[model samples]
Target: MAGQQVYLDHNATGPMHPEVVAAVLPYIQGGFGNPSAPYAIGQENHRAVDRAREQVAGLVGATAGDVVFTGGGTEANNLAISGAFLGRSEPMRRHLVLSAIEHPSVRETCAWLEAVHGAEVTVVGVGCDGRVRLDELAAALRPDTLLVTVMHANNETGVLQPVAEIGQLLRDRGVRFHVDGVQAAGRIPVDVAAIGCQSYSLSAHKFGGLKGTGALILRDPSGVMPILQGGHQERGWRAGTENVPGIVSMGAAADVARRDLSANMAHGLALRVIFDNLSARIPQCWRNGHAGLRLPNTTSLCCYHADAMSVVLALSSVGISVGTGSACASHSQEPSHVLLAMGLDEQAAFCTIRISTGPENTVEEARWAADQIAQAVERVRLVTAPEDIGGCGEDCPCFAHSSR
Candidate 1:
């Protein structure tokens, strides 16, 4: 295992669990019949899809029939946001409410609604801790607001929003609510009934399943129309031929997550504890997001005067991997919108990095990664130190004291 990398970026995506891969192998190899066909083999495949539906439903306290499989979390979010507006005929009820810290999938979908459909969008900002300001949300709500879409957990900072409270606020008002639970589903305990969201999105790959598979759990599918139309699959809620192997793996992953939820959470928290302890000793290392209300696996650190990209590259060279921000938006030169909305200045946002751990990570790995990160930060500082700051070399006590 020499030079093997330690992966600490689970929020971006996760490796498939052993059980999930085993469950999907047979379907990938030989279960090639179309679920829509009437032949015996097709019928067997149809049953497999049904069983998957139930397994996914069980993860969120939903019924099998309420789950509509989609391409991934992005599609599920788009369908939930757009389909809600398209299904209704009222031009007056065109306003949509969303959190500023939402994933790009939800944020961009709302932007599309505003640009193409002439709908009004109300974006409520988050506080310094990265939790949505509930008061601002309440003030932004109007009678014409069609639906409120909030993510259960933020992707970059892993801040857990007050989704259950938001749901309760909108529940009696007859307005629909959607929770993009892509990051929250397998990492934390999620109950669709308990959260009381009308629609919830989940990505299979996020919870140790294969990519290219996801589902939208709905309370009532009658209220939402299909985003893609042509085939009659997913009871017409979603169209196209099913991904049999991916669907099977998603189910297997969900089953494993359901059984290991508590243990997995504990494992993640252990990693975070190590990170927090190490971060305390690193100069100018400020932790972002809510301390107690954040995900157990995620720790967002902002190192003043140290470039985030440099830290990422330095770690990569040392056989450790982390993220600067959301992998989906990493291609952009712009700093994270989530961090900016949380009141971080442009420079601080640029200096931020996210470390999200998975269940397989060991304590030794965590400690080693922490030490390497500290060294990398020191190396970057030494290389970039200004000439005016004399004697601020790697061993300078004055520089270290000032950084504190």
Candidate 2:
């Protein structure tokens, strides 16, 4: 029972930690009550939600009062982008800026503002290494620029942006700054006061908590408005009954992450070595994203002259979990807008696989996963090759062909 399967897609969604599960079980089964109700059980549920806020805020170096809970990262992102822009006074601010390589939630939110709300948007492009240019960011700021939103880590590349540098640049500019910390929240240490961003967003599932619960951190100076209005919930920022159990689990998970991130990063670093070596053995294998300064758990490798979906399916057969591009946007065949904006061609974009390691994976499990992946890539490459299409050394049913 110790090592039956290897899960290497933590970036897509980390497995729920047992401690978090244990803490959350009672809330789901016995502690079910609406936080808004005036009864004793409901008040108890509200306290659990408040405690979760403290845990989350502690992880980000903020007070619990500043955290506003939302449905998930997407909702948090939407609330941050749309809510902040909507809160601005007319004539004082009219422009918005975001990184081109941002998650779709941010990218799409910016687009919606421009198309639907008639706001001006400027999306700065990243270089080949998937980093936003700080100089470009400084140049783009305007007197009318209402907000600047960027991610702490790229969902596709795991490459971190210069958030503190950007924050410093915007310090005196009077522009409200927002950061999407959904991917980087628990994987890396985040200090909101030090980063100096006025607001930030995060999802529980990304960091080993249950899905459908997230938080938006807002500094009082930013004065963001609520996207929806109902009761006094989330201090009128997001209105819905507080999801007490999910919040309780998120707090439990946050506490665990704060204590265990160093060890988690170490485990990831070990797995990355095996992952990199396996990709190196393949023809034209190229590792994308930050070379050294990256998330410890993520490896985005592109196999040249092969199909990514095909390779993914082959590994899935052997119970290896992975992702091609952002799991949120995988339904679309269009190249990862994040990678493409970072200077990858369509072919390179299509050939990518994202593997993220968890603390549960052992070194042997990591190596075995690498072996299976290498074999799968080779098998798929041979099948897709025109010359090898007709003949086979050891004929096997082509899973990739059937999937296509």
Candidate 3:
């Protein structure tokens, strides 16, 4: 915000909403009493927490009692996955199913369950369009499958999964379902009951709240076990002192998202349309994910012969920000697992960049950002593969490579 930069990386994190910041300041200043205590000061803080919980629950179509605030989306996802598995009474219900393109929190937690807890995990793959194969998921479900975890919207590509359909399938099979609704909650109208997930996870940060707060909305909380064994903070499902300021801000953010849902969605769709029209002029650029089944705010495109990291750095120098993939996977040198799972080869995966817009972004900014992105891609291609610069037509290797 300090420079001439145009940020198009809302999927990674977003700036706190102005109202959320205002609402959080008072809590940060003098509301120091513990929400768990019984004194008057403590009751004031407790009320604030309760009010925030209600706001968060309302955003996702759940009751306040069903929401358990966590440190972040990662913790919420972990709680949903491990807690659901731990709740199974029958020894026969020891297996779980997951999508191949789930966030690392869900993917890694499932892996841990398999390695340390002796649970069996089956990963259903996604198609080239980046949507999970419902047929494969249905086939993967077994008599012993205890839980099925799938993300409501993909973080990298912003592909929306058919959660409602999957939920009905799991319901018919009498298995527990968990949906990581972090990317879909604020941007879309999420009805957890309609989706029919036992536990649905949402991150405040992704929707203009503070980074340290998130929630797990449990349709029924009785079956789950506490992942943290400390003081019972989140109805004994999660432990430790509550982050009062973060939680308060998260609540305010949720309120803002609820109030502005329609306008924000329209704004995001407009920005995406602008970005697509502009970026199409760049050579060797094509979007990934399903055209209609993805988030209106997101666009993932591959610019052949140009490394994603290089394009990011080049754009950064010109005061524009974008993401190669999930910010959580930023440090890894490996290609994006989401792209790879969608059938992109190693080289194509390396060349993909994710651009996501927010409510504050404008058509003018989108145009400028698109120009900068095209320039960055051309610059990277010049350095990475200079021989491919002037080559044109179907016969040229560069042309053939770009067509993919």
Among the numbered candidates, top lDDT falls to 1
Error of 1 at 8 (Å): 0.5
C-alpha lDDT (0 to 100) for residue 285 of candidate 2: 91
Name the regions of candidate 1 deviating beyond 4 angstroms: 385-404
CA lDDT of 344 in candidate 3? 89
Query: Comparing 2 and 3 by TM-score, which wins?
Result: 3
lDDT of 1 at 25: 90
Error of 2 at 138 (Å): 1.4
lDDT of each residue in 1-404, candidate 2, tens digit only: 22356678888888899999999998988999898889998888888999899999998898999899888888888888898888876655779999988888888899998999888999888888888988788888887899899999888788888999888889977888899999888888899999999989989988889999999888653556788777789777778788887788789988999999888888778888888776668878988977887888888998876777778778887888888878876655667888788788877788888888887888888888888888888888887863332232334554334344
* lDDT, candidate 1, at 249: 86
Instruction: Pull out the clashing pairs in model 2.
Output: none
Cα error, candidate 3, residue 168 (Å) = 1.0
Residue 21 alpha-carbon offset, candidate 2, angstroms: 0.5
lDDT of 3 by residue, 1-404 (tens): 32587889999998998999999998889888899999987889899999999999999999999999999999999998898777766767888899989999999999999999889999999999999999999999898988999999999999999999999898877789999999998999999999998999999999999998999998866557878887988778779988989999889999999999999998999899876664478877788888889888999988888888889878888888899877776655567899999998777877888999999888888888887888888888888873332233445453223433
Evaluated at residue 144, the lDDT of candidate 1 is: 94
Off by over 4 Å in 2: 1-4, 385-404
The C-alpha RMSD of each candidate to the native structure, in angstroms, is: 6.5, 4.6, 6.1
Question: Could you estimate the TM-score for every candidate?
Answer: 0.94, 0.93, 0.94
